[model samples]
Target: MIQFKNLTLRRGVKELILNATLTLNPGSKAGLTGANGAGKSSLFALLMGQLHADQGEALLPPHWVVAHVAQETPALAVSAIDYVLDGDRELRELEARLAEAERDNDGVAIGHLHAELARIDAWSARSRAARLLSGLGFANDAIEREVASFSGGWRMRLNLAQALMCRSDLLLLDEPTNHLDLETVLWLEDWLKGYPGTLLMISHDRDFLDSVCSHIVELANQTLTLYTGNYSQFETLRAEKLARQQGDFERQQRQIAHLESFITRFKAKATKARQAQSRIKALEKLERIAPAHVHSPFDFHFETPESLPNPLLRLDAISAGYGGKPVLDNLSLSIESGSRIGLLGVNGAGKSTLVKLLAGELAPLRGERIEAQMLKVGYFSQHQLETLREDDTPLGHMQRLAPDAREQVLRTFLGGFNFHGDAALGPVGPMSGGEKARLALALIVWTRPNLLLLDEPTNHLDLEMRHALTLALQDFAGALLVVSHDRSLLEATTDTFWLVGDGAAKPFDGDLEDYRQWRLARQAEALRPSSDDTAAPNRKEQKRQEAELRQRMSQQKKPLLARLAKLEKSIELLTTEKAGLEAFMASEEAYADDNRARLADSAKRQGEASAELERLEEEWLALQEEIEALENGYPQQ
Candidate 1:
């Protein structure tokens, strides 16, 4: 368990947490969330002992091992698997001692170290490291590559894999999904859901938090508030709480009304794909959750395009890639004014290459790209963040775009992205990633382009900023093509999906869920055994063997299936009861003096139920993995 007792944390003159107390029990998965500069990372520092509290104390069990992803990864010559194995300090230490014992010819010491290694299951450490790397999107051969050979993002994935490799009781992750693709993000979710340790992660991805976190701790106004359930539940509860406050009520109502208006209007708009309907539903849900973010600093929308050109951009028989190699070949696609497309693929599968082609940043290796006479493209990518002049500020950048526009107009436009006062005037050199990203977005929106090509735009943005961006994109009457691991953003803004893989880019006739299923099936097929005998097997013998294997597997899974059913039922009952308790707690009546005792009881019961539910969920996940292994013909450990 981790505890903060009357903790007052300060970084220089600024106070982050003021007399905040929080207790996160063992094995509880918590999501740390707040605005960009809201001390979420500072709180993590407090737990990791990297920073001391200004007053009181932050405590963790003395024996518990803590692991966190490194902010920087040096260019190491060691193989990726070795770097990951180094995360297990105990294993590394024992192996060192064993080598020393061997050199000294000490049989007893060598035997003892081997026993300890077995106790820690160190023999399988490499395999475990490989699994982590695989889930993080490393190819099998890449796992054996030298760490120094990988790019920055791939190196970050190595850092993550190393952190996960550590057999720690407490794990702290900050923006774990930053460099991940959607498939990798989904894989990470499953891995985290099954993690047996206490996880405190900071992520802006709402869907990721909902899938992986059992609790959410929000830092706001120098206060820490712990909420039961996931991000969605926290948002709902917070919305209800804010709605009752006189100061916030008016603002909340206005935001809700604005979202409702958008939804009502957009519902009547014809869309080219079923995902458009999904986006509409997502927006409606966003309207319900709007109050939770009423206090967000960001408030901006794309300006209406001067012209709505049909087929804003077109690619014909394109072959796009770097150098002489074609990553995507023979691809033809058209982006119209109403095209709202989400790009889906594994990392390095030509999604970005396609975006580069559409953005006119990369010329097609072989083919033609046609653009409308009125085509105006607003392109954003992580690389663009680097292009910002360090000596210049947001105002200066905007001035470069519209030299004739008045400074006040530029300043006012920048304010919509929450770059105000000194933030707008200061050099971009000292700005945080989120601030720089906001500035980049402000610059793009000022162009009033009819086409937007955003690649992982939400990488450094917080939840509020992400929500604001989603809202703005929803209202933008232009074509949008986005590549992001943030499922919420993809679901809310895109009406179609294009799968970029197999050396080509093409329309994927399905939603994200379907893609997920397709990915799973693909993985299963890859894992299934393949024989190179070339000769066709006898059909009758193959059928008999398959039947026998199925019978055996069915018998083995029967008990596990029964247990899974029972666990599901138990989880359902507990969840319903917990919801009832939370509903009471959210009610104004729960705060009354007369109902204080009842409130306390309900709170206690809710905590217990949450813990129990977490336990059941973990077990259920383990069983699921076991079942999947069986179905895939892999032996469970």
Candidate 2:
């Protein structure tokens, strides 16, 4: 158990957590959440013994084994799995003792150490390490490579894997989802749910927190508050508490109403997914925390394009890939003004490749890519971060993007993204990844692109920025194609989904929740032990085969799935309409309005459309079942 009694913590003269008392019971999986500067990280530091409480006591049992992701990963020549195995210090020590005993010709000592190793299941340590790495999105080949060979993001995943490798009584993870794809996020969520430890994690991802956490612990207003249940539960409880305070409820209502407006506009892409509902509920919960962000430094939105061309982009029977090899074959997609699309697939399933193709970074090898002459594309990806000039400031970057824009106007826009004062003018080399990400996004928004090809744009973004991005995406009158792992972002912003698996970009007939189930099923099939007793596939062997199998199955049922997707899209519109009307009715203004004619008409239409939507949805589901059954059929053995 971890307990803090009237704790007051500070960094320098700034008070972080003040006069806070909280208790986390043993084996409690708790999420620590707050604004980026709201002392969440500082509290983790206190728990890790890197910081001291200024008053009272912060206590944990002395015998508790703590595991936390290292902020800095050492560049080592050791194999990544071996480096992860090193996280199990006891296992490493026992192995070392065993080696020494063998060298000394001490048979008795060697026997005892070997038995100890078996007790700890040391023989399968590599396999366990590989699973952790794989669950975090590392490929099997990457697992055996030297640690120093990976890039910063990949290295961060290794660090997370190392932390998970340790068998401990307490586990602390900070933003473990940042470097992950949707596939890995699902895998990690399942793993965390089964972890037998007192877990404390700092994450901006609301969906991840809700999935992994049993309790929500928020640090704000120099206080630590604990609530029962997950992030959604916490928001409800917090909203209720805040609703009683003067100005708090009003502030929350304003923000919620604003969010509801965007959500309504983008409902067609977001309504079917439960995660989007979670966000809507979360935003309604934001009605409780309005005071916290009343003056949030970040308040930027994308500018509407000067020209929104109909059918902003069109691809006809395209074959796209890298180095002359096709990753997407005979793939065709049309992007029109107001298209809100999300791409879903396994890793290396060509999600990014599709984005690159849309951005014209990769030319189609066999198909025609027709772009509207007025199409101004704003492309964002993790790789774009590397393209930013390290020596330039955020303002400098924006100036270069729009040379004709006024300096004061550009500075004001940068300030909206929280790049103000010296920070706005400082060199990018010293900026944090989050800061760099914000700058890259700022530049892209400055371009007023009518078509956006964003690949994992939320990778290094904080909750606030993610929220802003979601809102901006909703308001932008543009064609959007996004590849992201954030469920909240996907559910909130995208209206349609495209599967980038099997080297073909086709409309997917499901939502984010469905995608999670699909991914998990695929992973389970790939990982299941073979029935043949004599020749079981090794973990690495299974992963390699899994990738290949997904690739092989990518092109199957393209036509049927695409048609089903079209039908589902119609259902999406109906569902979105009903959901939006209900959302409006949930507001106080609907009941007021000086008159009730609009409310009556809305209620009448809602009743009319509800049954129609159900019929369309049912038809869509039956079609999906037929396609699935067909895909599953095979010749008798």
Most accurate candidate by lDDT: 1
How many angstroms is residue 509 displaced in model 1 relative to the true structure, after the best TM-score fit?
Answer: 1.8
Q: Which stretches of candidate 1 lie over 4 Å from their true place?
A: 245-293, 533-637
For residues 605-631, what per-residue lDDT tens digits would candidate 2 score against the true structure? 775676566445444534543443332
lDDT score at residue 269, model 1, on the 0-100 scale: 62
Query: Which lDDT values do the candidates have, in the order given?
Result: 0.82, 0.78
| Model 1 lDDT tens row, 444-469 | 99999999999989977888899999
Segments in model 2 whose C-alpha atoms lie over 4 Å from true places: 53-55, 72-77, 102-127, 138-152, 247-297, 316-319, 323-325, 363-368, 386-415, 419-429, 527-637
Q: List the residue pairs that clash in candidate 2.
A: 252-287, 269-495, 502-554
Whose TM-score is greatest here?
1
- In model 1, the Cα lDDT at residue 266 comes to 69
Per-residue error at 394 for model 1, in Å?
A: 1.8
